[model samples]
Each structure stands twice: as C-alpha cells, then as structure tokens.
Target chain A: MKNPYQDLPATAYWRTAVADPDALDITGLWQPKFPITMTDQTATSGSCFAQHISRAMQNHGFRWMDCEPAPPVLSPESAKTFNYGVFSFRTGNIYTTTLLRQWVRWALEEEVPDSEHWERDGRVFDPLRPQIEPGGFSSVEEMHGARAVTLAAIREALVSSDVFVFTLGLTESWRNSETGLVYSNCPGTIGGEFDAARHVFANDTYPEVYAAMADVIEMAKVVNPAIRFLLTVSPVPLTATASGQHVLAATTYSKSTLRAVAGDLANAFPNVDYFPSYEIITAVPYQGRFFEPNLRSVRPEGVAHVMSQFFAGLRSVGVEVHTEDQQQTPTAPPRRVPTEEETADDVVCEDEILEYYNAH
Target chain B: MPTDDHRFALIGDSNSAGIGRVARSRGIPFLGGPLSNGITLDGDFFDVEDGDFLPRVDGPQAAGFTGLFKAGLPILSTVGFNTQRIAQELHHGFYRPRGLDHSALSDNVLRQAIEDYKPGTVKFYRAAVEEGCDVYAVYSPQRFPEPWMALALRLERLLSGMLVEMGVSLVDVRPETTDEAGRLRPEFFTERENDQTHASDVWSAMVLDRFLDDAGIGVMA
Candidate 1:
C-alpha cells in the first residue's frame, strides 16, 4: 500500500518540532556536526562582530594572538583612543570578503596587483585596513611605511597562529581608486576626507564572496601550514545601505549571500568550518534575550547560549573545554541609554528645593 | 601640683599649629606666634612658663617641686604650632644628623621635631617606666597620596618592629581618621566648605577629647 504522507516524508514533519520557522536551509552546502575543535593560536580581525570572537577566544582559554596590543600602561583616555584588538589597534570594520581577502593577501606580503597604499594621519593604509585619522596621514611616505609595517607584522604573526576567526560584517565597503584597497569605516567616522571618487561600494555576489574566502584560507595556509578558518556572519543589521534597495532588504541580501558563501566555503574546504553565531542570535527561537536594549550586543544570556553551543560543538569532537567559566565571557560594549522625555511630573519649582532643604 | 610648672606641647603641622581663627579658640595656647584677641579665649599667644608655652589656668593652681620629681616626666617643650620652627631648631645643630631629606619635606620636618624634642618622650617614658605619666602622639591633617598609604602600611610594619627597639609603641592616626582613599575623613571637618586642613573649634574640641582619652587626662575645668 502507498504511504498516505509519502511526498512529505516523516523526516520533513520533524522540522516543525526543532527547526526555526524562518530557518532557510543551506544545510546541503554545510551542516556542521555537534562539536568541532581545533588547537590553533587564534587571531580575530574584521568588523565589530570580530570583537565578540576575540572575546570568545580569550574567554574559552583559546590562545588569542593579540597581533597588536596597545601599550600596557595607558591613561583611560589613551586606552579609549588607541582601541586595541586585531593587530593591537582598532581598525574599524574590515567589511566585505574582498577586503578580508586583501587583509590575508597583504598579511602574507604576496604580490597582489590590486594593492593600493595611501598616506594619511601618521600612518599608511592598505586597502585591507586603511589609515583613518582625523586630519589624515602626515605624508604619503609615512602612510605607505605604516601600511607596509602593519602588513609585515600581521604576516609574521599569522605565520605562528593556528586559527583565523573572520566574522563577515558588511558587504558594503569603500575601495581606493588607483590602488584597489579597502577602507574600514569611511574617513569621516574617525576623521578624513569623504570623496566619493576615492571609494567604491562593494555589494559582492556569493561567488565573489566564496572566492575571497578561499583565497584568504589558501594564503593563510601558506603562512601557517595548520591554519584553520572559521567563518560566522555577523547578525548586526545594516546601519545604512548603499545598495539603493530598501535597507532591510539589503541587510537580508547581505546576510543571505554571506551565509551562502560561508556554507559553500565550509563544504569546499575541510579545514574551514562555519559557526552558527548569526543563527543563534537571530533565529534560534532564543526570544529577545540575547540583544541589549538597543538591539545590539548579545545580551549575557544570548552570549551564554552561543558559548554553550560552541562548547557543545567542541565537546562532540572530544575537544577539552577550558573550564574557566568566569573568563569565558567577553565584556559587552556599553548600552546606549535613551533619554526620558520631560513631562509635567518632572517639573519641579525652585521654591520646592529651598523649602525641602530648609525642612531637611 | 603647680599648674605654672607644667608644660603642654601640641606638636604637628600648620593644622596642629592652629592656623585659622576658628581653630584658635581651642584652650591650647598659641606660643609660637604673635597674639591678638582674634576671639576672647582665642588669644593668639600661649600663657608661658618662662619662655616655653604652659597650659592656661582660669583659677589659682599651685604645687611643689615634689610633684615634678614624683611625675618624672620630661620637661614638655611644646613645638606643635609650626613644623618650620621645629625644622629650624633641629637643623641648627640640635641633632647630630641634620634633618635634611629625611623622608619627604613634611616627614623631614616632623622627624626633626621628634629629634629636637627628645626631652618630652625621654622624660615621659622615664616617669611612666616605674610610675604613671601621660604621653601622646597626634597626626595633623594633610592630603596624602593614595599610593603612599599602601607604602605607608608596609613602612609602618617595618617601623613597628623598630619602635620596639626605640622602647615605645607608635599609634597610627591614619586608620582612625583617614577614608579608604587615605584622605582625611570628611566628617572630621567642621568648616568643610573651605580649603582649610585646620580643624574648626568643634573639630579641635573633638581632637582634644580623643587626645585626653588616650592620655588618661581629664580636661582642666
């Protein structure tokens, strides 16, 4: 007898029980196992999401290669300014796969014809991490030297690091004209000229994204033979979109394409793996527990959820979970408090203050 | 006991020396500086026994040489008013090792006073060794560096062991009145709105009360 529910298999019915209603399955490309583990001195560099990964590595007892760190002794204001992370300095938003590719290519010091260097502020900027200073680099030479040294140092550090955790942040980025280098944030975010001619936005396709990741992974392997790559698409929605499309649609498209690319790369490269950080935060039915009041920064509970999955993945593969629970969480960026609107209830007369003070 | 024969030294910095008008009214005499009737009881000069300052008396008070012999305490040479005067006396060949760069500029002056006024501690200890005599140490208000408090704690441990060698116990006023950050406790100030480290009349009375408590002395009515 023919089964009545033949077309929709019993397995398909189970999706309602476990899977997110919005979960789009690119699982055919790469369905990760429960636990995965790798022992590599890891370095994270990318967009703001990369901060989370850096923190996670530090928390999880993973060897975090702080390729660059601000001087240990610094005044609070100096510490705030010299923002340390990737390459021991804050180079805002290393968005886009091509930019990520450029970072790896430059870090390896390989001859990539598209390499462009600029002098601004006191340093040089490669397309991978452009020099962002308020007034711009002092001279072209200083800028170029800085870029060269930064690239050289990163390559040197990568040669010894085992894992490179790259978080795909934005598909939109600004590129240089004569030299095809990428700038992190636009010049104005820190301080520089915002000339449209000097930059082009990269709304990359999935194939382009895949190729970029493959190139970086290949390049990283050359530096460190055992280099493993893990990719996660940042769940942070777009602040603005250059794609002329609706910002919401553009965000979906950007995330979807990157997610597809990540799946493709994980399938293609045995050493590469995809973590469901974006999924855990966005669609895992975790409710709204993860995001801060501003809908940014994974709430402590959300971070715990992600870390739990991460550790579960490690445990499944027999990787020892470093038992430092206290250190396993990274500090979240400060939440922006909304100002309360003034109402009649807030209005207090000066006479009241004097009256109260005298009585007290 | 003869009140004229008695000497009462209040040693410290400008704060201890009674800098402001509000601080001047404490019953202690202002021996080191010129006197004007800033306030009635706050005369700018101390009533003296010879040249050295003596405690003031409102009534007839007389005694004999036997009281001095019985007390066996050192002749109190009060230098509480100004550290500068104490620094001068010690540096002007009073102590063999000149009070130059002893620790800090402030500590140097204070240590100089200690050396120059050995008569007070020595005589007090001699009297108290077999019988009973009153001796006290007081710290004046000053802003101390936060980091130095920790260093001072360690130094105090070292100083404590050395104090035994010197045959005396040292009392730390820091723990009693300093806030956690090593600043003088805000509550200690009566005239808090000003920059004065000098105690006000109320604060002076409070400090004097604490001193009498430690010295086992009754306030002279």
Candidate 2:
C-alpha cells in the first residue's frame, strides 16, 4: 500500500511550500470550497479586524453589502463615530462567537436576552453595546427603537448574504448568569454598575467556544441554505484580563482556542472556510513588523498584505473577481490604523476603562 | 506629558455660555482653578438619596434654592431633549415659539438656523471628549414662566442628563440665579421677556469658584 505522502505535490513540505517563512509569498494560502464571487453580497462582523475585510472589499471592487447604510446627511467621519457603515449592520463589534450566536438568536427570535438597559443620569444604555450610542440613548424607548433596526439588519445579513466573514477576537467575557445574557463589556468598567453577586466572569473553555461557532453555522445554514461562512481570527492581543492569570497567558489561551474553533469549523463543514490572515501577520517569518509599537494594532500594510493573499488565492482558480473589479478603482492604499487611532480602538477594547481607572 | 495642559471644557445650552460672558465682563480670568471657599453643597438638586447618577462634583450649585421647586426639584429636566430632537426640528423647520416670549416672525428662517446649531451642540460636547478635556457642564438657571416651564424643564433634563451620561461633572447654578417663581432673575436676561438670556458677571464668577473647588485644579489662581 502506498503512503499518502508519496503522491502529494512538493507544496506539502516545509522545504518546498514554506521555504522562507520570513519572505513567504502568502498568496494561494486560502481557497474556499464554495467560491465567493465579486457579485455576492458579503456581510462582515466580529472584532475590529473584521472592519478590514469590509473596507478591503469596498476598495477591492467587490459588491460589499451594507443593509443599513448611513444617512447621507452624516459625514463619513461623523457617521463612523456612531458605527454606521462599519460592517453590514450596526451591531458594533460582535467580538466573540458567543456574542455572534447571541445576536443571531435575538434576530431569529430564538432567545431574547432580557430587556436590560443600564441607565446613568437618565440616559439609557444597552449593555449589549454600551458605546453604540455616544451618550447612551436618550431614553429606553429610543434604545429599543434603534435596537429594533439593528436586529432587522442582522436578520437580513444572516439569511440573505452570500458570504459572512467573522473575525473572532476573545474568549473571556462577562455575563449576567441569572439572565443568561452576555454583556459587551464588564459592567462598571464603562457604564453599568458592577454587581459582584449578579455579574459572573467567564473564560470560555474550548468546547463552549466551539459549540457556539458550530451551532451558529448550523442555525444560519438552516435559514439560508445558500449562505457561505468564511472565518478569520483577529491577531490583536487582549487589552486586559479579568481572569487571575497574567494577561499574556490569557491572550494566548483566548486566541489559540478561537483559532482551534475556526480550524475545526473549516474542517467539518464544506461550506465554511478559514483564511490565514491570522498566520500571515502573526507568524514568525514577518518578524512582527505588521504590528504597531503597542505590538497589538495591525499596521495598515499588514491589512494590505492579507488582502493581497486573499485576492491572489482566488486568482489562481481563474476567478475573474478580485482583479477584474480592481481595474476600475486601482485599489486605494491601505488605510492603516496609526498609533493615533488609540481612541478608534474603543469599538475593539473596553479594557481601556481599566487603564483609565488605574491611572486616575 | 505636561501636567499644565490637562484641559477642562464647558458645554451645554446658552446658560453655560452665559457664565463665560459673565467672567469676561468682570475682567477676571476664566474661573476654573484652585479652591478657596469651604466646599458647601448648599442646594444641589440631585437626589442622591434615591440613586447616585451624576458624576461626583461638589453639588453646592443650586444649593440655596432647592426650596424654590417645592413640588420637587426638576430632575424632570434630566430626561430633557437630545440632539435627535434638534435634528428633527431642523428637518421640520422652525419650532413655533409657543409660550416663549420670543417672536417667531421668521419661523422658517429660524428653522434654517438649525442647519448651523444642532450639530454645533452635539459636535462641541463630543469635542470635549475627543480633545481629552475635563468636562464640567455648568447649567445656569434659565427659567421660564408657567406653561413654558414644563417644556423648559424637559429640555434641561435632556441637556444635563446628556452631559452626565457622557461623564461630565455638573454645576447647577440654579440656586444662585433662579427666582422662587421659576424664572430667570429680572436682570440676567437682556430684557424683561427673558428671550435673550445673558448671565451677569458676578453670577459667572461665583459659578467658576464653585467649579474650581469641585475640580480641585485651576490655573487662574
């Protein structure tokens, strides 16, 4: 009997396939089982890195889908301040697989996280997305009204889009155990009052995380049989950790667990695909230059590199998508998040609140 | 980072602007510095006994006159109007003066003014945060007569509560300026109608003093 390695192409070996991890041409590293054409309506969500996918698609000449576009009255700058056009919908930073599942369930009316609104000085804040509204919603009724629009947008994306790309960021999160509701950030850190007895800290185990990822795919597939899922894990590190472990250890565990989940999903489901945007930026070959001084934020060139590989992979298959569309726009240079974007990180990290409290 | 540059900012309705006007009129430097007076939270309208919502600023503002609102201090204004309302009014064009003593002779033209003002209110306050300024929203008592008082109270709730939600400290100057009858003192307004409300210089100086004591940092000395 012939061993499986005998017939495989030289591309399988470290010597041939990955000759120099440092100068590795990452093109063709990812190929989807189900092709995502340029014409497909694509929806993007998850961590801050996911914004790159949406933006890249916009500049790369794909028909990037936006269900709830910003009103023309708002400038692109101001519109982004309130999270308009950041993703397919306005559900700011889905952040985790669990939160993604939670949003899906809410949109499908499968589960309703209690009608919980945290109030400060009479302004109402939705705990699910504390900063979605800058000064909180004017009233609980207004909060609900805006929430209704988001839920609708979410449902539209889930059941209708041809491609759904999610970039999972963390495993640790705080939840109200009694209500079985996961909050956007730990209460008291940003807006809600911290209640020791009521709020519970959770660092989700692999099985828990994997189940969420798998279940959402199954659930969404049922709703829209044609929907395809593409997954990426954010390369950003954890900002702060509530677990007793050191933040470095916590970030490693979180990212690794999420990566495992993405890998597993890609292996299990034919329709689900995993892209190596994570590997291209985080791998040793690049010498970590893709990251900024904080060693967290991905340099703009890093995003540009990831998209280069993304389009390159498709081009190999004779797909006239990524390149054909780019001819018209010639793809603008990567709009990297500079160190000055310390504030833009708000959508990605509430850990800054801890830093603020400690400094004060 | 230089410690001297940590900035503080003021944002709110015309009342906050009024205090700035008052300080400039008196020939005193802007009043947000070191504390001198004993911290006396005389008539703070905040009902901390019920729930603590506002940021911890010394609540002496409106200290003496908490009694004027015998029925209840108008925390009702805490729920007052937001930029959304202003935006809506802009879309619809001029809001009729209603019981406000100001004439709406050019209601349409007045509405055109929304094109300039609503974003001003929202953007400036947001700037206080963007520029990392320590925000102290000084709310002077700009009272209105009977029927209009209810609407004015709601507007107050909206504006003050907005600042508080955005994590700004409050200095309710009502205790110093409001008459027992729920109207601005006869002099704060440029005219008896209370339409063109402007605060006096002395009133501005007192507010700045209270703010300095609350913030515990001021450059003007």
Candidate 3:
C-alpha cells in the first residue's frame, strides 16, 4: 500500500528542498493563488517593508494605485518629507491589525477616533497619523482637514483597487485606555504625552489579530466585492518591546502570531493569500544573511531576492510578468519609475524611533 | 513735487515700472524716473533695456543698496519685485505653502524654499532696514482676473506677512483695484491686449496716491 506522502514532490521534503540546495537556490517558496496582472490596480499599506512591494510593483510597470499623490508642486524629495507617496494613502505604517481595522472603519464611515489632535509647542498633529505632517500642522483645523483628505483617499483606494496588499508588521501596539483607539506609534515617541493612566500597552493574541484582520477583509469586501488581499509578515524585528520579555522573544512572539494569522486568513478566505517573505528572510536555511550590519533592516539584495521570487511565482502560474520596457514601448505614455536611489533601503519605519530611547 | 531736498527711490518689477510710468506721465519727479533703469541693492543704476524690471544687479557693488540708503531716501517698493520669476518657476508646477487652502506642502518645505527663492522686495526691505531707511512695501494689484492668479495672490499674502513681521510699512491697494468678485477690476487692466500680467497706469495712479497718503507726503496742487 502506498502512503499519502510516498509520492510527494521534492519541495515537500526538507532535505531535497532546503538541506541539499544552496540557500539562494531554494525554489517554490510561494505559489501565488491568483494572477496579479499588470493592469490590476494594487494598493499597498502596512509595515515599512510593504513599501518595497509597492515600489517594486511600480518599477515593474504594474499599476500601483496611489489615491493621495503628492501635489505636483512638490519635488520628489519634498513629497517624501511630507510623507506622501510612502503608501497608497498617508496612513503611515499600519503595524497592527487593529490599527488597520480602525483605518478601514474610518474609511467606510463605520467609526470615528475619539482623539482628534495632539499638540506640542503650539503645533498640532493628527493623532491617527502623528508624523505625517512634519513639525506638525499649524492649527487643529488644518490637522483635521488633512486627515479628511487621507480618509477620503482611503475610501477611494478601497473601492477602486483590484488587489490590496498588506504586510502584517507587529502584534504589539499602544492604545487609549478609555477610547480604545490605537495609534500608529507610541504616544510620546512621535507626538502626544504618554501617561501611564491614559495609555496602555497592548500585545494582541492570535485570536484578536485574526478577528481584526477578518473584519478588515469583510469591511473592504463590502466596499469592493472583487478586491483580493495578499498578506505578508514583516521580517524586520521589533525595535523595542513594551512586553516584559526580552526584545528577541517579543519579536518572535509578534512575528509568530502575525504569521499564524496570515496563514489562517489565507486558509479561511479564497480571496486572501500569504506570501512567505518573512520565512524567506528569517528561515534557518538562509542563516540570517539577508539582514543589514545591524541585523535588523533588510538589505537591498534581500528585497531584490524576495521580488524575484514573487515575479517568478507569478510566471510559474502562467501569469505574464510584464516588465517596464515591455509595458512602455515607443507609443506608450511615460510613467514615473522611482530611481534605485529612491527605493533602496528607504523604508520609513516609525517604530525605529523607539530605538532612540535605548540606553545602549 | 515738494522741493524739500528729500529723495525717494521707486523699486520693484513691472508693477513698479507701471507706477513710474504713471508718475512720469503726471510730471512727478522720482529719483529713478523710469524704474526700468533698475537700481541694484548696492544703489548702482543700470538700465534694463529689455523693459524687464527684475532689478538684476551685476559688477562691483556693495551687498546693500548703500548709495540710496546713505542718501536716506524713503524707498517705495512693490511686493511683486521677484514675483514674476517665482510665477515662472511655479508654471512648471503648483506649490502652495502649508496652512493655505488647497496646499499640500509643509511649512518646513516652504521655509527651506525661502533661502533659494526669497522675494526681491523682501531682500530690498532687509537691505534698507540695515541702513535705517524708511521702507514702504506696496502690495501690488492682481495682474489678471483668472483662476491661476490664485497662487499669485497667495504668494503676495505670504510676502505681505513677511514684510509686516519685519516692521516694513505695507500699502494695500487691492480694495480699490480688485472687484467685489476678488478679481482685478477691468478698468485697471493694461491697454496692451496681450499683456494681462501688468496693471494699467490707472491702477498705478491709485496705488501711488495711496502710497503718498500712507507715507505722509503731500503732492503739489
């Protein structure tokens, strides 16, 4: 009698797939569930690592939808300083699923955040996206106005996008003790005063993360029934942990929880799929070679490798991967592809600000 | 003109040139008759034969308009001295300073741009202040009654705020020159059909009268 595992592919065995092959040569890491064609309007938001995916999609002549583009007057440098074009909208780094859920609710007019604005040195900041406007807005009215624009953009993006790629970043976040509003960054790190009584640290368990992400998908599908989700777990470890555990252990917990949620969501929803970027970078077979000198930031080569696998996976599924050169022939209109200097290792991670408080 | 031996210098761009034309037409004797003869910050008079009154300075002159400052001439300048150049730059794209309506730029970005793109009127005011000359910055009338002129209006407001912060007196003539709809009144438009970016001599006369009133200088009857 033949066992179920007796005639499996080489990819199913650790020795043939990982142990025997060179780390970089390992294949079949991801089999894309659906085809991501060039014409598909894709919107990306989540951790800083998600930026690479957005930029790569643009660079490859894919239609990476940017609903809230920087005004034409801004130079590329100025646009970046103002946090425009960093993500599909200006909701910088939706690190936690609950924050993602909150943004979706605001976009769909289902919820409103209690904290309107935070003030420091006479300058106002939007509590939802504190660091979006550099040096803060001039007034509370201006902060609200800017947030309204972003919320509108979020709505447009959710409704218009054919694919929404969200890289789940962390399980740990800070929340308002009373309102239960989640902030993108710790209150005091970027703006707002951190009070022990008013602010509370939250390390979401697997169940909470799962439910929030499911709600996000359900809410998005309500607006855009055809929208497909591609989820990934960020490989960059947590910069600091409010949990009493060591930073390393906290990172493992966060990554494991996020990874499990992503896997389960992909299993639960036909439209949802997981890409193994976290495992591709962090797995023992790779020996941590993809990290920078600090052993935290993903190197440019690592990003390139992950994208190669992404494109390769699409091609393996018979999806024609259209390159920029092929998409933009002599008759085609010009499109702006960010230069290598702009996209290379230029992820804006708000959590990295926490490292400033490190005693070491 | 009063012969009190008090000298006055008119400085700025085409709008200032328009004022000079009106003053010349009215036989008013200003130190620089036609400001088309551009005066540098160092007080050197150079003819800008092209009729572009941007006050482009060259050659060996001090950093400040020392000659006119030393003469203690009350300087009447137009806030639009460098606005034409800025308008040309902005034609490449639209950029509004933050806090204004429809603006996407932050104050920090606009502040950084000031070093590279400070208005000529502001620069002139600073030089005159160093020499203790009484300076009056006239807010020029809107050149055109078009939607694109909104940026120009916003820029004028920005410069006006800067001049006020520097304690430079400002003569606002918009109430008289602009219509109820916030456009330049058609009566103040130039005779040249092609030139919409310059006000007529009628507008200059009104501005000059307002400037004279604010400066406390009496015209000969």
Q: Write the per-residue lDDT of candidate 2 for residues B1-221, one digit (tens) a residue.
A: 11223223322223343444444444444322211110111112123222212222342322322221121211111111222333333232222312112221112222223223344443434434444445565654453334345434544555566567666567666766778755668665443222333345456666766776677744553
Best by DockQ: 3
List per-prediction Cα lDDT, in the order shown. Answer: 0.50, 0.63, 0.73
| Segments in model 2 whose C-alpha atoms lie over 4 Å from true places | A21-24, A322-360, B1-221
lDDT of 3 by residue, B1-221 (tens): 22344436666544576676667667666654223211122133332222212234542221223345555567787633434334333433343322224444444444434423553444556656765777888775665334336655655666666667777888778887787766778887777544545567788888888888888777675
TM-scores vs. true structure, each candidate: 0.49, 0.59, 0.77
Candidate 2 chain B: worst-modelled 10 consecutive residues by lDDT: B34-43
Please give, as one word, the docking class of candidate 1. incorrect
Docking class of 2: incorrect
Weakest lDDT window of 10 consecutive positions for candidate 3 chain A: A345-354
| lDDT assessment of candidate 2 | 0.63
Measured by TM-score, the strongest candidate is: 3
> What TM-score would you give candidate 1 relative to the actual structure?
0.49
Model 3 residue runs over 4 Å out of place are: A113-115, A322-360, B1-13, B26-137, B143-152, B162-171, B175-198, B206-221
| Candidate DockQ scores, in order | 0.01, 0.04, 0.10
lDDT-wise, the better of 1 and 3 is 3
Which candidate's lDDT is highest?
3
Worst 10 residues of 1 chain A by lDDT: A341-350
